[model samples]
Target: MAIIETRKLTKSYGSIQAVRGVDLSIEKGEIFGLLGPNGAGKTTTIGMLCTIIRPTSGSASIAGYDIVQRPSAVRSKVGIVFQDPTLDTILTGYENLELHARLYGITSALRKKRISEMLQLVDLTDRRNDLTRTYSGGMRRRLEMARGLLHRPAALFLDEPTLGLDPQTRARIWDYIRKMARKEQTTVILTTHYMEEADQVCDRVGIIDHGQIIALNAPGNLKESMGGDLVIIRTKEPPLVKIKALPYVREVKFNDGVLEITMKDAHLHLSGLLFMIPGVECVEIRVPTLSDVFIKLTGHDIRDDSAEDSGSWIDSVARYRQKGK
Candidate 1:
């Protein structure tokens, strides 16, 4: 069953449309990723679904409650971990979870039980009493994850959950997220620019660009849609015309003295390519990746776009919560 659904969901900031006509249906207990560059309206879409930002048109629901019509009910069914840290520095990790539990109106006995279970799940039980200020970046992130799940929400929204962490730390954090999602049986909806991480962690991802969803599928299926591997050949003189003439070559581009050839069964054609093309200084065969799929669909690299939508969205979430009081 779909735990989260949206139809023609849109948000406009004056003339700038942050999200436009986005339609999605995410299944229960599924790890769904909104994969895109920084300014691709990933955050805006999440904000609308989380009830932090009202849509300009269309509608969305979380666990059966309409976001705009039943904001309070939708909030009750969802928990959010923002891009920036929202923990109280002075409070211990346990205290932070305790406060969140109380705010969610979880009973005392259930609160303690949930907090203990979460701390143990994230391997933070050992340092639960330590002040959040003293926790390392990854530790703090784990604590936030624990706190978000304290109320046993039906869905969890993670906005760029590992933005600033190092590679190893990012991997470990993803591991924790997967582990906890299974144990809690909560649907996971995350927005991220990290293509490799999305490929590794998300069961399915929607490729959002310029406030629209261009494609949506499992990572492998999307890569397969590209139809071939990439063979990057570096040389001073290029044979662009001849390369494109080849029947197996799907696409060819020559830039900065390097020729990128997309072809089916690259390994079989490598010898012929080297023999036919002179001045072959280097050749590398690479399997198709999510990044490759993005470039094929958009013409330019994903990172070529700027972070135009990088608003202080976390602050917006805070203000929305304050207004609820």
Candidate 2:
């Protein structure tokens, strides 16, 4: 049976539809990824399923209990790690876990054993008594992870779990998640902006764009279904209509001055495509990837909006609308 199931799940905030009709089925012992840009509804979807937010329309179930009709049961079956840290820094790690166990109504007899196992799983057994504020960013994340799993929920929800950690720390946390998921036979729902993380950790990913899933499949399968290698070119000005007319090209998109196209047997089409397009300065041909799949589906990269890349979005929107006209 599916550990989590949704049918046309949706959420709206006043004038904005944060999540549209979304259907998902996550099996037991599977690591599923919900990947998208900042406001593409990844968190809203997770929030609704976790019973933290009610869907404006549609239905969902966690661990076979309806989210709307049986919220308490759904909550009991799921554990969540939010993007921001929610731990009390003043308290010791052990104290936090103890509190979580008490709040969850974990039996007193099982509380101690469960907390110890969680701390060990996150590699915090030795420092379980230290004040959380004394811990490093990675350590604190690990502690939060441990607390989330303290009750041994059937489903684990991680919202950008390693957002601010260093590379080494992020990798370590991923290892712990994988280890715990396998050991506990838990279903994990991960939402992350990091492409490499989703590519590496998830058993399958649902690519959400503008509040709906545009693609869903295993990472490798998604890449393979993109239909052939990518042939990229840098040109002064891409003739969109002319390029679209090129035979053997499955898809063509011109973003900025970079022209990206997919073709069956890219090696066979690369030289011909480069020669046919005018003002070519550089050329590249490579295998498709998850990032490529996302760009193909959404027409934009999944990047943090705090960076320089954020400013270009206005111009992109303008161009997109003008093209629509």
Q: Which candidate number would show the highest lDDT if scored against the true structure?
A: 1
The number of the candidate with the highest TM-score is 1
Off by over 4 Å in 2: 230-285, 300-325
TM agreement with the true structure for every prediction: 0.79, 0.78
Report how far residue 142 has shifted in candidate 2, in Å: 1.0
What's the C-alpha lDDT at position 266 in model 1?
84
lDDT for each candidate structure: 0.88, 0.86
Candidate 2 per-residue C-alpha lDDT over 112-209 given as tens digits, one digit per residue, 9 for 90 to 100:
99989988888899999899999999998888888888888999999999898989999998998899899888899999877778899999999987
TM-score of 1: 0.79
**RMSD for each of the candidates:** 8.7, 6.9
